[model samples]
Target: MSDKGLHKTNQNGVSRRGFLGRTGSILGAMALAGQIAPSQAQAATAGAAAAGPIDNGAHVPALVIGTGYGGSVAALRLAQAGVDVHMIEMGMAWDTPGSDGKIFCNTTTPDYRAYWLRTKTKAPLSNFLGFPIDKAVPRYTGILDAEEMGGIIVYQGRGVGGGSLVNGGMAVTPKRANFGAVLPTVNADEMYDTYYPRANAGLGVSLIDPAWFESVDCYQFSRVGRKHAQRAGFPFVFVPDVYDWDYMKQEAAGTVPKSAVAGEILYGNNAGKKSLQQTYIAQAKATGKVTISPLHKVTSVSPASGGGYTVVIDQINTTGDTVGTKTVVADKVFFAAGSVGTSKLLVRLKATGALPNLNNEIGKGWGDNGNVMCGRANHMWDATGKVQASIPCGGIDNWDAGGAFAEVAPLPTGIETYASFYLSITKNPNRAEFSYNASTGGVELNWQTAWKAPSIAMAKTIFDKINSKEGTIYRTDLFGTNKIWGDHLTYHPLGGAVLDKATDNYGRLHGYTGLYVIDGALIPGNTSVNPFVTITALAERNIEKIIATDM
Candidate 1:
């Protein structure tokens, strides 16, 4: 559908075109606050339009903060249940193409669309061959956000689709046995039998073809990884993803536009990957009762004098400046801003007395999901081919015995690195807490760097044995000189307003009647796998009950 068709009036008679004159920038205010090269600015200027806007002071039946997994699910279900919903996102809509004729830049090429409002890029792989690889870029409202909080860096997606736009599309579900630890309060059978399948179907999850997997040249790195794991007496499993496998096959055959094959995972994928924008968000838009306002940040939500709640929003430009402030009323508010965003907002609200009645367990249980990265110098005979696919299709499962499940991640450096990369999701027990700092008027997460020791130890249970078997050593040049483990950052940030502790079993905040926590903030610590699938399933389960009862 064209961008103009996305701005139709909803049931509440809110015409989005009325608010277009308020700002000159259409949709997301392209080109780094209108300071980019003329040619680049021209391309972004000729791109698509924004979502149906929710005008200032317009009342909404439901207001959802952040358009990640939980928010998307909530908006869709609520709209289906006869409620007009409006979603507020802090980042851009990401529906426009740049000078490169692509909505997103490649992983290897860091452009203005890479980092979020930063003058310099903060790539996860900071160093290569003992040299720093960070570069300067124009500060803008990009998609990926590398948030530095105290001792750890949490990488989150910043646009309307949230983490789905930047993630590797690994839709992994935890084992049935490990389900007990993931959400001990929720029923295991209902989740596995009903919600899990529903979430998977809703996400369009599918496995890679085994026949093509063994023959494809793009997946040569995964083949090498599988051989190494099998030789080391570890089980090698094919983890399903949300990437369009047929489209990937077409890319391998030179029959379509390349995305995953062109090393486009870190920033965003232009094609072949099924992000939330392509799935739930699209479905919600099709419902005609859901509208979204991009570049609008929800700063405050408190009880109103009449009833419901009052929400304060800041409309920002591309350079992160608040251009206008608007206050609206919402019958109900759902906090769906990923783990960090939701936790930080709630912590500040509680401390600043905007939400005085919030329970003491608001910011208690936060964790990094035991995310750790490492690389092994494979022998020259086992060359992980120069042509590699960015979407990972396999992993090493050691969770039952060693408390770790390692994904054989892609290097996609566009060259033969001769190194085996692995990102392990271990069973680390260290949990952090977010506290409000009165001096800075900001939230601080008390997660120490030393807390990653248990994660590193658990990850070694897989790499150490494989290294001992293959007679290979750890690669010291990838992360930094003499630094073997990438323990400073976490791609999977889970928890804060933990289930049953901060909220009820169904994610309703304890003290607030019309408020809810429906995102990864409800999951405690770890999900034993890539947590998006579990996050979606839990949202499906909770929102189903919520719509059936609350609405």
Candidate 2:
């Protein structure tokens, strides 16, 4: 569909055209300035590859390690450019339905299918009023992964879609100024003019009808959040998403299968969500030059005596046990295993002499994107509605003064929690390093849980204003035993191998010619918004350059 077709009048007589007119103009100016011709933009979505089974020891021209945003974009673009590619994902495919005929487990009734390789559920919000709300479940390879480091619990999605399978689907582009600050070496003109639009279009991003947002039962929580934010004299902006807005409207009206309205995010969305498996990965598979090996984890990568790299992989089962080991040679390798995964692999490889030429900057500049979660105890009159959607649509933007963008997150327990929850992204300068532990032969992040203090301080600037304006207080029962802040975990981990320092300008690693780092690890710490859009755009920009010159 064209951009004009995306603007339709809602039932309340509000035209989405008027709501998004300014946004459209920005995109238009970008297109004009960049001179992004029709063919170039169309080329972004031109190819579809049918994935075939991976031959155990076969050699390929390109190998992408990870199926997240970076890996998917690399695989698709490389395959479209006629470089045959193979992808390795460490998680389940997630497209198969269970015996109950559901593709995913809902948040309200989390079972063994809710977690990855864990016996007990390790929810980000693990307690209510000092009591543990988590339960034991059978250990299996599930969708959400709460990976534990020394002092932090990093939440990530462990499936073919990576974080897309379990995130709230907020597709936000960073402010232009913020983007420049986050990645100084990147050409800001190219990103804003060409790559951002290309990434957004390819991801199928859409905005909710403002009229429906005002009237829908599922968005009552967001409305309350907007009301409180505005009362505090803060800006509340609607966030675009990769979800099907029309299908969400049908879900609200009971005319279709309910996923967002039925508390089905975080665990996984059964419908209406455009995860990578449904978008980039699917398109890559249709190209006939790309293949994915789910449940296959890359263990080592070493330079081959005969010009390529030898990649050691382990095919694991549902119980987290390695069933078979295989090695393959690739002429080129791309690391897209997310920030933590890629960082761990690189740090281990460097320390263990597998790739000792990798610079000391390989494991530095790791951050949590300044994540902090808090809730407000609302008054009796401030009912947040009984039917709440798990997908968030709006946020309080106080980035200028407090350096925080507070999302009105969902409390989709299928009940009236009467609390206003938020997950704020702040500008924190704190970063940690990943070091290899020789004794245990593992990589460890030197980040402490207490390092989130700066982020908490920044987030409080926004919520404190809202609390004072609404005459409310912080909720002390959501995160832990009277813990007001959920500072022990991070949902957005970014930057380990930074762009300019660890790699050349276009994600080409300094020590290696055919190796690249194209994921969130390329960004330096934070993007001041959700990291996915920036990750996608950067991958788009880098891959275009790679295809033109390096390939």
Candidate 3:
């Protein structure tokens, strides 16, 4: 890992030693087996029975590599296809309030190791592959080296749903022109005609009405953004978000009591937003098609003699402790672990020769959306007393030839009020250097901001776009600008095991078969919008081709 001093020791006090030797977790039909969602409980029970001894196959067949965005979609799709899918999540499942007193991990606080940190993410593929696995612990910083600290810290959620839980519930599919430009292989219009809406309804995105925004405290900040954007003459669209507008309205109305609304949502939202914990993964569970095995990390990928593959797992918790890993074999596998997770796993696997011939296109073209966040604020009163900054109400496009900017609206509980303007690159190809260090034998992310000359120019344009456009809350008529980069503080990351021009545009790892990266990791380029929708859509498109025809 390139981050040496960045990671603080596990604050939850779950020592790496305490986590390793703990095992003997067995669940029979009586141990809450009947409680599975209509879809996947049976698979959970089946996996439970087959999971006793690693190779014994007591339960947990059809290992799905992640429980995050793409993996969640894949698991549900496979499960609905009647494949007994075992989904692996490195972080423990959040304890949803149940009828009984049975305790689950409370993600709202650091009650268990899972809630110990403010920032979260995932990468433990499976226990089957050995040697050369990605790091499972969620580190706070990626590459802070000389980058400016900007507004609204961008973090990833680590637990069962990966970043979906921690994210602000922005359900983004970029503008038509922007989305189509990335996939040279797939027909952009055809994809829009086919996969985009399918992916949206799957994630449950709805519009934010102005009346609803009028009542919510967090949403009030967006009006400031709209005013500023209108002043700057930029097109500001009230975006569709995964966050439930009805629930937000209820929270604002005080009828729906919420700790989530009380906490302002950056660290984690337990009560309000409909993150994956409450949505697709939930539905996936209901489908009887998918089963989840939390705290198991993928070690490597090895070709089995039986014409399929084995995904080795580390079986560890968030505290860097061991919990006895497993090696499960799957006739078909999809790597949906996020960009960093999947890339490191595939790259290291290839480097150590565990799964050889991973092609020359394996670990290159890693980009972080050329992401930047900055703010422009002034102490001014709105009609409602003050403008509490909210998520993107609008953005500027013209100046950013290679990027786009959105006013990131953040409604902190009290006192400080600000909106975060996020700049996702429209055309950033600045590649970050990735190498496996033998001294530590881990992946190093030497992401230098200096490499992003075009993006830097675009970043300056976007922020200037944001600044030159509006000033409703400020005292001055003309906006003064302050620009900065918060390390690589972006939830959107692409590339690293990218689609090489040298390889097929389908993003084959060149030399590997029976191996396909189906997550955000396969997108070797950046987009001007949040990358998840595109990632999920692309995964849907890829899997449909792979399993339906390629199989």
Q: Who wins the lDDT comparison?
A: 1
lDDT per residue for candidate 2 within 382-446, as digits (tens), equals: 88987887788888888878889888887876667688989999998899999999999999999
lDDT tens digits by residue: candidate 1, 72-98: 999999999999999999888887777
CA lDDT scores, all candidates in order: 0.82, 0.79, 0.51
Runs of candidate 1 exceeding 4 Å displacement: 1-49
- Between prediction 1 and prediction 3, the one with superior lDDT is 1
What clash pairs does model 1 have? none
Candidate closer to the true structure by TM-score (higher is better), 1 or 3: 1
Give each model's clash number: 0, 10, 43
Better of 2 and 3 by lDDT: 2
TM for every model, in the order presented, reads 0.92, 0.91, 0.75
Strongest candidate by TM-score: 1
